[model samples]
Every structure is written in structure tokens, then in C-alpha cells.
Target: MALDHSLVGVASDPVERTWRAGDVIVYALGVGAGAADPTEELAFTTENTAGVELRVLPTFAVLAAQARTGRRLGDFDPARLVHAEQAFELHAPLPVDGRVQVVSTVTGIADKGSGALVSTENTATDAETGKLLVTSRSGVFIRGEGGFGRSGPASDDWRLPERAPDEQVRYRTRPEQALLYRLSGDRNPLHSDPAFAARGGFDRPILHGLCTYGFTGRALLHALCSSDSGGSDPDRFDAMSGRFTKPVLPGQELVVSIWGDGDGAALFRTATDDGTVVIDRGRVRFH
Candidate 1:
């Protein structure tokens, strides 16, 4: 069935979500924290490290803002939908353990000839204090569900810089990376079940797009937001957004190339070791 355009601009009822220190740590590990060196990133991966307070990764906001009570887009095969873009802005450093009231809205539906891009925005607020915590925006492309004759909004004026990147960071994913990342609330069979993946036209299970996003966020956190002492400072990491241009398989090395855009912002692209651009049109703002 085609997507329900009437859902656009409709906000869902608030849903409350709670997380603990353990949940935060699991999310860290799922995203490759402490993988290179067990001793590194203790603040994010350990809760009992003395003199090192437990901290949350800024990208965790993506999971924190997810709400299952949102309006249904339509009744189409789930395999036909894929994440196309993601963006999130943090209002403050996320607490190690907290409760949030999340509300999601279907922001827009754009026709792209071959497919439809359904965009959504979610806001997670501190349940107790009522303060806004994070705002997340994402788009999903549903194959064979377009051509309704409605044009979408104009695209952003994003372009790659001509010069070389200021810095580049690379990290390798484990063969079991998708298995680990799946523990953090995303149980999509496309990332785990080989048979389900085959239905999606993948020879094997593919890594979660958000998992790749988390890896890229880690590079940005350390390269641009680390403290003078070389410790990752989550507070300095503000906002990030990117488009998923290709699927990433497990155990592939990710190379993040960043070009500084001046005034505490940058543009980036995440590619595989062989130079396949998996995530493109990336942008980030930091302090």
C-alpha cells in the first residue's frame, strides 16, 4: 500500500522511556566503544571506574528519542523501507540514567519517482523537569511507493570542499558487530537473519545504518570535541546529520574524512576502506 500522506504534520501522543547506567554502557559498547583498547573509553563503557565518572555518548540520543507509538506510515512490506537520512541535536549532555517523554511527528512525505521519503522529527524531554533533552530528525525511503505527483521541498546546498580534509579517522568493525549493535533496541532482522537479509537483496546481513552513524559520531567526538587532556567530552559535541548512500556490511573498516567549515562546524563523509562512500552529505556542529 502507498504511504498515508494525511499522516504528515500529525504528532503522536507522548510516550515515556527510561534508561539506566547499564543501558547507556551497553549502547556504548554496541557502537564500538572500548573495542580498540579495553582500557580506553572507560567513562562510556564502565560504570564503576573510580575517578572516572560514567558518561553517555551523544549519539545515544538517537535511540533515546525513538518511540514505538508513532502514527503508522502505511501497510507495506517492512523490507521495502530503509533509513535514508538521520540528524540529531543535543540540548545538553544526556544523563547517565533518566526518563524521557518522547513525542514524534510525521513531518513530511516527498515523492522521488522511484520511492517516497517519509520524514519524521522526535523530541525527547526530561520527564521530571520537563526540559527538552534532544531533537532527532530522520527520513526513510520506501521503495516502489512514489509517483503520486507531489514534489518535495528543495534540497540543501551542500557541497564537498576542494582541499584535502583536515583530519581522517578510521575504525574497523567486528564480524559480530551487527549482533552487538542489535542488543541496543533495534531488532530488525535485516541486520541479523541471513535469510531475511537475502530477501532484502543482501548476500549476508548488513550492519545497521545507525551503527555506522554511531561510529562516525565517535570519530567526531574525539577529533573535534575531545578535552585538552585527550578525553572525549560529550558536552562539546552538539549536532550531527548525514545521508546513508550505501549499505555497510559487518567487519568492514570505516574511514571518516572531515573538512573543517570554520566557526565550530564541519562537513564529513564516511567511506569504506575501499573508498565506497557509505554515508555522504554529512554535517556537524560543535562547540
Candidate 2:
């Protein structure tokens, strides 16, 4: 069946979620924290390391806000769904352990000929203090489920600058990267199970798009938001958004290029060593 356009604008009931310091550490490692050297990102990879205190990555907001919507878009093969875009804004730096009440809404369903783009927005608030915490927006493209004849939402006016990027950082993914990242609650077979991946037109399992996002987020966090002491400061990171243009296999290296866009923001993109852009139209706002 095709997607249910009626689902648009429907809001889900509040779902509460809680995360511990351990969860944060696992997520950090999932995204390649300290993979190069355990001692480098001690703040994120370990909760206790002498004078260094543990800190949560800004991208952790995406994982923290993932609560069951208790609603389905429509009937279709799960493999047909692909993460198309993702963005999140942090109202405040996330704590190592905290409880949150999350409300999600199907904000839009646009027709894109071959498939439909279903967009969602999630708002998470501190359960005890009732203060806003994170707002995340994401879109998924469902192949073979479009042509409903409805025009989708307008695209953002984003264009790359003509000048060279101010900075570029590269990180290599381990061959077992997907295996580790899946532990962070996204158990989709697309990132594992070779047979399942083959069915989705992949030679082998591909890394999760969000995993790539997390990797890119790590590059941005350090390049633009690091503390005076050279530690990653989540407080200095405000928001980020990006579009996934290609899949990344495990063990491939990722190069993140950032251009200062002025006004405490920057435009960035992630590519492989061969210069194939995988994540494009990226933007990040920081202190």
C-alpha cells in the first residue's frame, strides 16, 4: 500500500526515555570515539580518567530523542526506507544520565516520483524539570512508494561557497564499525546481515547513515566547538543538519570539510578519500 498522507500533522503520544552514562559512552564509541587512540577522546569514551570528566557528544541528542512513535506510516518493505536527511538543535548540553519525555509528529509527506519522503520532528524535554532539551528533524525516503502526485515541501536555499573550506578532518572507520554502531539501538539489518543487505541491492552490509552523521558530527564538534582546554564541549555546539547522498561501507575513511559561514555557523560536507561526497548540504551552528 502507498503511504498514508493523512498521517501528516499527526502527533504521537509522549514517550519517556532515560539514558545513563554507560549509554553515552557506548554511543561515543559507536561513532568512532577514541578509535584511533583510547587516550585522545578520554572525555567521551570513559566516564572516569583522572582529571578528565566524561562528556556527551552533541549528536547524542539524536539517539536520546528516539522514542517509539507508536504509529506506522504504511505497509511496505522495511528495506525500502532510507534515511534522507537529518538535523537536530540542542536547547542545552545533554547530561550524562537523564530522563526525557519525547513527543514526535509526522510533519510532512511529499511525493518524489519514485518514492515518498516522510519527514518527522521530535521534541524532547527534561522529564523532571520540564525544560526543553532537544529538537530533532529527520526525513526518510521510501523507494517504490511514491508518485502519489503531491508536490513535496520546499527545499532549503543552500549552496556551497566558492572558496576553499577552512578546515578538513579525516577519520577511518573500522571494519567492525557497523557491528558496534548497531548496539546504539538501531538494529536495522541494512547495516548488518549480508543476506538482508543483498536484498536491498548492496553487495554487503553498509554502514548506517546516522553512523556517518555521527562521525561527521564528531568532526564538527572538535573543529568548531572544542573547549579552551582542547576538550570537546557540548555546550559550544548548538545545531547541525545534513543530507545523505551516498552509502558508506565499513572501514572506509571519511573526510569532513568545513567552511565558516559567518554568524557562528558553518557549511560542511563529508566525502570519501576519492572525493565522492556522501553527506552534503551540511550546516552547523556553534558558539
Candidate 3:
């Protein structure tokens, strides 16, 4: 079905979401935390132990993103929808367990002739205090659902730094990474069942894009925000925006290359250990 331009600017009903300490640990595990070395990411995957202060991964905000924005956009086929791009801003550190109000809005829609780019923006706030926690921006591509009328918005000028990375981090993705990540709200067959993935043109189940995005966030935090004394300081994170350049298979070792712009902006690229860029044109900014 074609996209109904009128659906743009519509807002979804405000919803309340609460997470427990266990929930945060599960989310951390799903995104590849502590799987290889528990000591490295223990603050996220393990808690209640001596000297451990549980913390939530900044990218977890996307988990509370618009769950039903596509349906509200129009009668577009769910099978053809693809998460095209994602951007996020963190205002404050998320409590290990607390209640938050989530409200989603259909911010904009762009017709690209062959498909429509639907944008949904989600804001999660402290349920009681009404303080904003995170703002997540998402864009989905609806195949064969464009050509109604409107032209797309102007493109962003986001570009990588000209120099090589100042530092790099390498992490190996577990073969069951997709299986673990699927438990964190996204049950897409493309990231789970192999038979279902074959139908979608993949050798086996692929990793969820958000899972990869979370990993990048982890890398950035470790590289740019870790305290000189040892632990991570969440205040260094401000925003992240990037493009999904290719499909990342389960078990692929990923290398994150980071370049700092001296102004708290980080330009980065995630690639296979073999050097195949998977998430390109990435940018991370910090407060």
C-alpha cells in the first residue's frame, strides 16, 4: 500500500514503561556485553556484587522507541519495511530500574520514488519527575510504497573525518548474538530462524541493526568516556547518528575505528575484523 502523506505529524498515545534491574542486565547481555570478558562490562551485566554499580547502556533508549509507528503511517506491508537510519540523544543516565513515559510522533515522511522514508521520533521521560531521558529518531524504508507526491527532505551533510582513526576497538560477536538480542523486544525472523532468513536472502540469521548500534555505543564509551581511574562516566555521551551500510552476520568480529574532532564530536566506522565496513558515515557527539 502507498503511504498516506496525511499520516505525518500524527502522534502515538503516550505509554508507560518500567524496567527492573534484571531487565537492564538482560538488555546488556543481548547487546554483547560481558559475553567474552565479564570483568570488562561487569557494571552492565552484573550487579549486587561488591564494588559493582549497575548501569544501563545508553543505546537502550531505542528499546523504548516507537513500537507501532509503521502501522499508523498507513497500510504499508510490514514485510517490506526496513529500518534505514537511527539517531539518538541521551539527556541523562537511565536509572538501573525505573518507570518512564514513552511518547512517539511521526515526525516526517520522504518520498524517494521507489520507496518512502518514514521518520518516527520517540521521547522517554522520567515518569514522576517528567524529566526527559532520551530522544530516539528512527527512519524506516517502505519498499514500493512511495510515488504519492512529496519530494524528500534535504540530505544531511554528515561526513567522516579525513584522518585515520585515533584509536580502535575489536570485539567478536557470538554466533548466538542474534538469538540473545531477539529476546530484547525485537523478534524479527531475519535475526533468528535460519530458514526464515534464507527466504530473506541471507545465509543464516543476521544480527539486529540496533544490536550493532549498541555495540558501537559501548565502544565509544570505552574509548572516549572511560574515567582515568577505571569506570565509565555516562555524562560523556550526548548523541549518536549513523547509517547501516550492510548486513552483519552472527559471529563476525567487528572493529570500531574512532576519530575525534576536538570539539566533542566523534566520527566512527564499524567493520568486520577483515575490514568490510558495516556501519558507515557514523557520527557521535558528547556533552
Go through the candidates in order and give the C-alpha RMSD of each one to the true structure: 0.9, 0.9, 1.9
lDDT for model 2: 0.92
TM-score of each candidate structure, all chains considered together: 0.98, 0.98, 0.93
- Each prediction's Cα lDDT score? 0.93, 0.92, 0.81
Candidate 1: residue pairs that collide: none
Task: Tell me the lDDT of model 2 at 50.
Answer: 94
Q: How many backbone clashes does candidate 3 have?
A: 0
TM-score for candidate 1: 0.98
What's the C-alpha lDDT at position 233 in model 3?
68
lDDT (Cα, tens digit) per residue for candidate 1, span 1-287: 56888889889999999999999999999989999998989989999888899999999999999979846799887887889999999998899998999999999999899889999999999999999999999999988899898877898988999999999999999999999999999999999999998887789999999999999999999899878766989999999999999999999999999999989999999999999999999999999
lDDT agreement of model 3 with the native: 0.81
Please identify model 3 stretches exceeding 4 Å from their true place.
Answer: 66-71
Model 3 per-residue lDDT tens digits across residues 1-287: 45667767777777888878887888889878887788888888888778878888878877754344334566755656667889998888778887888888878888888888888789888889999988999888877887777776787886777778899988888989888888777898878777877765678778888888888888888888876668776667888888887789989988999988768888899998888898887888875
Question: How do these models rank on lDDT, best leading?
Answer: 1, 2, 3
Better of 2 and 3 by TM-score: 2
Q: Quote the lDDT for 196 in model 3.
A: 74
| TM-score of model 2 vs. true structure | 0.98
